[model samples]
Target: MSTKFPEIQGGGSLILAWQIKGKEVLVVAAGRIVNLLNADAKVTVVCPRNGLNEEVAYRVNNGQVKHVDRVFLPVDLEPEKKVAMVLTAIDDPDASTRIWKYCKQMKVPANIADVPSECDFYFGSVHRDGPLQIMVSTNGNGPRLAAAIRRQIGQMLPEGTGDSVKRVGQLRRKLRKVASGKTSRDISKRMAWMSEVCDKWSTDDFNDMDDEDMDKLVRYYESGEVPSFEEIRLGSRDHVVWEFDGTFGWM
Candidate 1:
């Protein structure tokens, strides 16, 4: 007997974080312009002055984004501009469809807000804290449900989780510097050590670590020694007086 379940159709959208930094993005209307701006996209909103909501107006006035002060024309998608993507939230379905066709012809990605079929991608409800970002998507089924789930997940995450992530990143960079020129086996060992540290250490333990503690951890990596959590927290390796100059070694 075949063990495979019956196939389900639809919902095959791939979730991704598009890197639009410093790239031109043509926004047909003002509704989703803020999201584009937040991603560091060089946004140019092609909408009437009256169409702009308060927030968008503020951004335009502040010179955060360029404003065209007119409705979107097919000319806006001219090849020389090299638009990375397009986002439209206009009320006119015909105009939106026209823009979508132009985007397709130009091979540019687009999101036509509320019209999932026309969108090449859907925006997720994002929860951000410093370097840590969690995005929840419903694959264009129910945005509200996705937002609710994101809220619950955010509430469950421990406080200072972002700080812990930043700390771990610093530790990883330090370990790489200390383990420089080591063999492939040694590199694998260092990776294993980092994995162990992440598994064994709590968020509180990472948040509690300061620069001095990080230095000691690097020393442990250099010597192929692993210290207990309590030993690291209590500065048991303080007497060794470790310092990183060129590479981490006994000084």
Candidate 2:
């Protein structure tokens, strides 16, 4: 056996989290507006009222999203509006193709829903928990499979992982304030120290941390001293233990 995996081909999509907050996003239909709304995207749906799904209709009526109340137009991508992205889910194939072409001509990114060939980007199956988001992408091959994998991964993750991440983020902010200086080396050292702390601590350990515990960590950072995980971990809780059978099963 060669014991080496063969090189894969044809999927070279670059995955990224598109920042759309406060930016205009034109959605051609109602199939996938909920995720946009969740991301705080300034969405404008270009579809008749009868075309909207129940949730979308409620959102439009509540003024949560702007509604055009008609079919999509080329003018929707007018230069002055500076549309950040377009997502078209309309049933008309010709109209979808036209919208995709217009987006390309206008140099705007677009996702022609369920039409991967026309999409500039494909939405991944995302596992969201507070400040933490884990996205699984299959390069437009299998969205349902990606979602299934996401669910499996989600189950494997320890509970309170999101809270741990949030706490770590807060600690990083506080550490930055404490270690603030003009030196690039200082920033590098702070980042390295944080990395070490994360590697040493488990999710449960982070969940057990309080303001006092975090303050102690900051003090250690300020003093240019690194504390062992045992030294900083609270005594109130027992350390989390993991056991594995060394076998993986598909859902």
Candidate 3:
């Protein structure tokens, strides 16, 4: 039977693939565990005295568990002693509930993979380009659909977009340094300067920038050379007003 669950709206860190690196994670299950070794999260897989641990021990190449135990001891629940994140992929619902409740009491974040009602967090579909990352979440309701949409969005992004992102970040740092050293206190002027720089930088211009081009552009911006107001007006497109009064209730 289908039931309607109340939707909770909140904002928190949308974890990226690289963010969990070097953190400790625990997976409790009886079968093959999906590999998380690439993320560099130290993973510990717990199972019964069966051969499940032995089978996994033979297959994995990197980030494999240093210790595979038959039971999770009570001492493991200590706030400072436990892993940062726990994932329960066990087939039993009752076991998942018990484990999740224990984790909650310990103030540890946990997820039951497909069992959203029992999870503190849901894994979202992620796409990455260097430092740039995009995450799509259906609030733990539709993971496969999220993955499909992520792939579509990934395909639409231009090649070398990550490089452009890096260049823009460098530009921002330069602008901030220049502002701190000499720019006026007027916040509006600073915003206008940013908009002008962004307005002149077209898609084609970004695509054409090689290492030499990027260096030159960086130097030009860092030199605190501002074009005349008339020149900026002539070169830039008119900014559009985004009216969200009707759409955003919070506004």
Give each model's whole-structure lDDT. Answer: 0.86, 0.86, 0.64
Off by over 4 Å in 3: 1-18, 30-38, 48-65, 166-208, 222-251
After superposition, candidate 1 runs with Cα above 4 Å error? 1-10, 180-191, 222-226, 235-251
Global Cα lDDT for candidate 2? 0.86
Sorted on lDDT, highest at the top, how do the candidates line up?
2, 1, 3
Clashing pairs in 1: none
- Residue-level lDDT of model 3, residues 135-201, one tens digit each, is 8887766779999999999899888777667766766665566555444644555566656766777
In angstroms, give how far residue 160 of model 1 lies from its true place.
1.1
From the highest TM-score down, the ranking of the candidates is 2, 1, 3
Cand. 3 Cα-lDDT: 0.64
Q: Whose TM-score is higher: candidate 1's or candidate 2's? A: 2
lDDT of 2 by residue, 1-251 (tens): 56489866665778788787889999888856778888888999999889999899999999999999889888899999989999988889998999999999999999998888999888899999888899999887788999999999999999999999999998999898888875899888998889988887889888988888888778888666666555766322355454577686668
